[model samples]
Target: MPKIYTEKHLLLFLYNELAAEEVVEMNAELAKNPVLFEQYQHLKSGIAALDSLSEEPSQTSIDLVMEYAQKLAAAEVANV
Candidate 1:
């Protein structure tokens, strides 16, 4: 019997979480199955968009974290 590939499997395949054999199987299915290929393409686009997001925090966030760390270190030094 042929395997029924779901969106879940496509996501796993996209993330390369599938086993080597499974990857091979999914590649074949994606080529052969239009609906599955479309779903995979949508997922790929979403992942690409997410990947394009700003990876670093804002400067204000960095400053706040640094301020807190400095205060904690000062308190520790005072305690010692």
Candidate 2:
């Protein structure tokens, strides 16, 4: 029986989480199914767009995280 690939499988393949065997199988399927190939292309482009728009946390956000970590460490020391 042939495997029926879903969007989740495609996402796993896109994110490099697919096993080597699965990668080969999915690639073959993509080649044979134009609709699957189109979906993959759309998802790939969406991921690229998201990557381009990604930004680092602001200084204030970094400082807040650091302060929280320090407070947590101090509380742990007190308990010890």
Candidate 3:
């Protein structure tokens, strides 16, 4: 019987989370199934785009965290 692959399986394969044997099986599936191959390509592109994103915190968030830390330190000093 042929193994059925889903989008989740494809994602795992794309992210290198699959076992070596599973990778081989998925590769074979991609080679024979044009639709699967296309889906893989689209997913690959989307992952690449997401990987390129920057996750820097905004200045306001940084300031708030710093203020919270200062309050914690002040409380600790008062308790000492």
The best candidate by TM-score is: 3
TM-score of each: 0.72, 0.75, 0.79
Q: How accurate is candidate 3 locally (lDDT)?
A: 0.92
lDDT of 2 by residue, 1-80 (tens): 14877888888999999888889999999999999999999999999999899689999999999999999999999999
Which structure among the candidates has the greatest lDDT? 3
**Full ranking by lDDT:** 3, 2, 1
Q: What lDDT would candidate 2 get against the real structure?
A: 0.91
**What residue runs in model 3 are displaced by over 4 Å at the alpha carbon?**
73-80
TM-score of 1: 0.72
lDDT of each: 0.90, 0.91, 0.92
Alpha-carbon deviation at 44 in model 3, angstroms: 0.2
Q: Residue by residue across 1-80, what tens digits does model 1's lDDT show? A: 14988888988888989988888988888889999999999999999999999889999999999999999999999999
Ranking by TM-score: 3, 2, 1
Name the regions of candidate 1 deviating beyond 4 angstroms.
Answer: 78-80
Residue 28 in model 1: shift from native, Å?
2.0
